[model samples]
Target: MIRLFKVKEKQREIAENANGRAPVKKQSAGELRLHKDISELNLPKTTTIAFPNGKDDLMNFEVTIRPDEGYYRGGMFVFTFQVSPVYPHEAPKVKCKTKVYHPNIDLEGSVCLNILREDWKPVLNINTIVYGLHHLFTEPNYEDPLNHEAAAVLRDNPKMFESNVRRAMSGGYVGQTHFTRCTC
Candidate 1:
C-alpha cells in the first residue's frame, strides 16, 4: 500500500514538472490556520502587522503598536510573533522587539501576557493577542509582571513609574538600561 502511494506521488511530481511549474508544497495545519487568522484580522488603526521575512513566510512577523492614550501614549512598540506549526493548539511565541520600560515586558523581550502563556486557548486568534498587547500599554498590570523592578515601581510609585516610562521611550536610561527611542 505504501509503495503504491509513493508511485502515485512520483507520477504527480513528474506531471507537475512536465507543466514547467514547481510542485506546490502542502500547507501544514498550523500554516492553514494562521493564513485564515491573518485574512480575517481586523486590526485597530493604532496597530500594524508586517512580514519582515516577506509574504512567503507568515510564521514570523512583526506587530507595531502605537497607543493613542495612557502612559504609553505616542510611543511606538514593536512585537515579534512566531507562530508554531501546531498553532491554535499551541500559543504563538511573542517577544517585545522594542525595549520599553513596562511591567509586562522584560528587557530580554520576553512578554508576560497571560494569553501567550497560561490563559491561551485555541479559540483565540492573532487579533485577540494584538488587542491584549495594546491593552497592556493602555493599562499595564503590575499584579503580574516580567520586569519585577518596573512592576514594583508601578505598584509603589505610579508617578515615578510614568516618568521612567517616558524616559525609556525617549531613548534614555531607565536604571542603567538604555532603551531605543520609540516615539513618533
Candidate 2:
C-alpha cells in the first residue's frame, strides 16, 4: 500500500525532473540537528575543522588544534570526529590522530577528554568539545590521568616534569621511551 505512495512520489519526482532539477534527498532528523549545531559553531582561533571527504559529506571530519600556550605549544594536533546518523542523542566519536606524550592522551590516539565521555550532554556541540580538548594540553590533570608514569612525574617532581616535557618535545627520550620528532 505504501508502495502506491512511492509510485505517486516517483511520478512527482519525474515531473519535477522536467524542470532540470533532481529530487531533493530527504535528510534524517539527526542530519537536520547536526546541520543546526554546525551552523551555530563558534570555534576559537586556534581550532579549525576540515572534511577530508569534502563538504558534501559532513558526517566524518577532522579538527586541528594548535595550542598557543602550554607544554604542547607549537604542536599541531589533529583529531577525527565521526558523527552517527543518530546524532544529538548520541555524542560523536572523537579520537586524536596525532601522537603526543601527555597524561590525558593515550598512545593509541584515544583522548581522555571528559566531554566526550561521562561529561557529555545533548546540549554540547562541536565547539564545546574542541575547547575541552584544547584545555587538556594547557592544564593536564594528574589526578585522572591515562598515562600514570607521566602523571606521577608531574605530581611528584615539578621541575623534573618540566625538563622531561622539554626533552620529549625535542624528539628525545624521557627515560627509555623514545619520542618522535615533535614540532611542539
Candidate 3:
C-alpha cells in the first residue's frame, strides 16, 4: 500500500471550513488496527465515548461509564485513552478521569486493570477494554486495591465502604482526602 503523510509527525491540516475536512492520515500497522478496533466498538448502554481534542484526533479520547447495576450505580466514571501511532500491538494508555473510591482506581486517576497492562493482547479492541473497565466499577477487587484505606474498609466493614462511597460521591470527604463531585 502507498504511504501518505508521515504517521509519527503528521498533523491534521484543516480546510477553509471549520467543518473539519482534514484528511485522515495514512495509518501505521498499529494505527490501522486501532481504527478497526474503534470502528467495531460495542460499548455498553451506560458507556459513552468522546473526543475532547476533536474528532480529527482519534488517537486520544475519553470513555464515560455509569454502571446501571451494582454498588457503583448512579455514579459516573470517566476513563481517558491515549493510543500510540504503534497501537493494537500496545494497549491504549487508559486513565481514570473521575475521582471515585475504588480498589482498582487510585486517587490520581490511574487505573489498575490487567488488560490495560501486562495482560493486554493485540486481539483486544476498544469494546473489550471498555467492558473490562465497566466490570471494575461493578465489582471492585478487594484483593488488589490502589486505595489501601478504601480496600481495608471494604474488606473489614462492607457497610462502611458503602457509606464512604456515598459520602465521596456527594462531594464530601472520606477522611483527609476530599473527593470532587460525582454522579455515581
Candidate 4:
C-alpha cells in the first residue's frame, strides 16, 4: 500500500512537470500564520518593515523606527526579528540592530519589553510587538531596564538622561561607551 502511494505521488510530480508547472511546496502552519500576519500588517508611519532575505523568506525580517517625538526624536533605530517555526505558539526573537542609549534596550541589543518575555501570549500578533517597540522609544520604562546606568539617569535626572540620549544618538560617548550616529 505504501509503495502504491509513492508511485502515485511520483506520477503526480511527473504530470506537473510535464505541464510546465512546478510541484506545490507545502508550507508549515507557522508560515501560513506569518503570511496572514504580514498581509494584515498596519504599521505606523514612523515604522517600516523590510525582508533582508527577500520577500520569499518572511521568517526573518527587520523593522526600522524613526520617532518624531521624545528624547529619541530624529533618531533611527533598527531591530531584527527571527520567527520560529512554531510561530504564535512561541514569540519571535527580536534584537536591536542599532545601538541605542535607552533604558529598555541593552548595549548588546537585547530589548527589555514585557511582551517579548514573561508577558508574551499566543494571542499577541506581530503588530502588537511592533507597536510595543515603538512605544519603548516614546515612553522608555525606567523601572524595567536592561541598561541600569541609562535607567538610573532617566530616573534620577531627566535632563542628564536627555543629554545622554542626544550624545549617544549623535555618535558621541555616553560615559566610556560610544554609540554610532543614528540620527536621520
Candidate 5:
C-alpha cells in the first residue's frame, strides 16, 4: 500500500512538472469555509473588508467600519481579525486597530463582545461577526464592557459619554488618553 501511494505521488509530481506550473497546495477545511464566507459576505455600505496581507493570506484580514448613525457616526474604526486554522470550532481573535472611547473596547484594542467570546458558535460566520461589530458602533453597549470608565459614563451620564466619544474621535483628549482623529 505504501509503495503504491509513493508511486502515485511521484506520478503526480511528474505530471505537475510537465505542466510547468507550481503544484497547487490543497486548501484546508477552514480556508475553504473562509473563502465561502468571504464570497457570500453581505456587508453594509459603511463597512469594508481588506486583506492587508494580500489576497493569498485569507486567515488574516482587516475590517473598517464607518458608522452612518449614532454617536460614532462618521468615525472610522479598523479592526484586525486572525482566524485560526481550526475555525468554526474556535472564534476568530479580533482586535480594534483604532483607539477610541467606547464601552466595549479597551485601551489596548481588546474588544468585549459576547459573540467573539463565550457566545461564539460554529454556526456564526464572518458576516455575522461584522454585523455584530457594526452594532457596537451604532449602539455602544454599556452593560458588558472592557473599558469600565467608559461604561460607567455611558450608564450614569449618557450625555457625558457622548462628549467623551466626540472628544476621542476628534483627535482630542479624553481624560489623560490622547486619541487621533478618526472622524471622516
Candidate 6:
C-alpha cells in the first residue's frame, strides 16, 4: 500500500517537472494548523508578530509585546516561539528574548507560565499563549515566580518592586544585575 502511494507521488512529480513547474512541498499537519492559527489571530494593538526567517518559515517567529498598562507599561518585550512538527499535541517552546524584571521571567529569559508548562493543553492555541503572556505583563504574579528576588520584592514591598522595574527598564542596575533599556 505504501509503495502504491510512492509510485503515485513520483508520477505527480514527473508530471510537474514536464510541465515546467516545481513540485510542491507537502506541509506537515503542524504547519497547516499553525497557518490557520496565524490567519485567525486577533492580536492586541500593543502586540505584533514577525517572521524573522521570512513567511515561508512559519514554525519559528517572534512576538513583541508593548504593554500600554500596568507595571510594564511603555516597555517592549520580545519573545521567540519555536513550534514543533507535532504542534497542538506538543506546546510550542517559548523563550523571552528580552530581559525583563518580573517575577515570572528570569534574567536568563526563561518564562514561568502555567500554560507553557504543566497546565498546557492541546486545545490551547497561539492566541491563548499570546494573551497569557500579555496578562503576565499586566499582572505579574508573585505567588508562582521564576525570579525569587523579584517576587520577594513584589510581595514584601510593592513600591520597591515598582522602583526596581523602572530602573531595569531604563537600562539601570537592579540589585547587582544590569538590564538593557527596553522602554519604547
**For all candidates, what are the clash counts?**
0, 0, 4, 0, 0, 0
Candidates ranked by TM-score, best first? Answer: 4, 5, 6, 1, 2, 3
lDDT of 6: 0.95
- lDDT accuracy of residue 78 in candidate 2: 90
1 against 2, candidate with superior TM-score: 1
Residue-level lDDT of model 2, residues 1-184, one tens digit each, is 9999999999988898898976677888878877887888888888898989987778889998888888778778899999988887788898888766788877677888888888888888888888888899899888988888888988998778777777777788877888766563
Worst 10 residues of 4 by lDDT: 19-28
Error of 3 at 57 (Å): 0.6
Instruction: Give a tens-digit lDDT track for model 3, residues 19-105.
Output: 766554576787677778779888899999999998777889999998888778889988899998877788888989888888789
* lDDT tens per residue, model 6, 1-184: 9999999999977988997877678999999999999999999999999999999999999999999999999999999999999888888999999988999999888999898999998889999999999999999999999999999999999999999999999999998899999999
Any idea how many clashes model 4 has? 0
Q: Using Cα atoms with residue i matched to residue i, what is each candidate's TM-score against the true structure?
A: 0.92, 0.85, 0.85, 0.93, 0.92, 0.92
Q: Which ten residues in a row have the lowest lDDT in candidate 6?
A: 15-24
Model 4 error, position 160 (Å): 0.4
Q: For model 4, how does the per-residue alpha-carbon lDDT over 1-184 read when each residue is reduced to its tens digit?
A: 9999999999978987897877777888888999999999999999999999998899999999999999999999999999998988999999999999999999999999999889999889899999999999999999999999999999999999999999999999999999999999
Task: Report the lDDT tens digits of candidate 5 across residue range 78-175.
Answer: 99999998887889999999998999999999998899999999999999999999999998888898999999999999999999999999999999
Clashing pairs in 1: none
- Worst-scoring 10-residue span by lDDT in model 5: 19-28
Q: Choose 4 or 6, whichever is better by TM-score.
A: 4
Please report the TM-score between candidate 3 and the true structure: 0.85
The count of backbone overlaps in candidate 1 is 0
**Clash pairs (backbone) in predicted model 2:** none
Query: lDDT of each structure?
Result: 0.95, 0.83, 0.84, 0.95, 0.95, 0.95
RMSD (Cα, Å) of candidate 6? 3.2
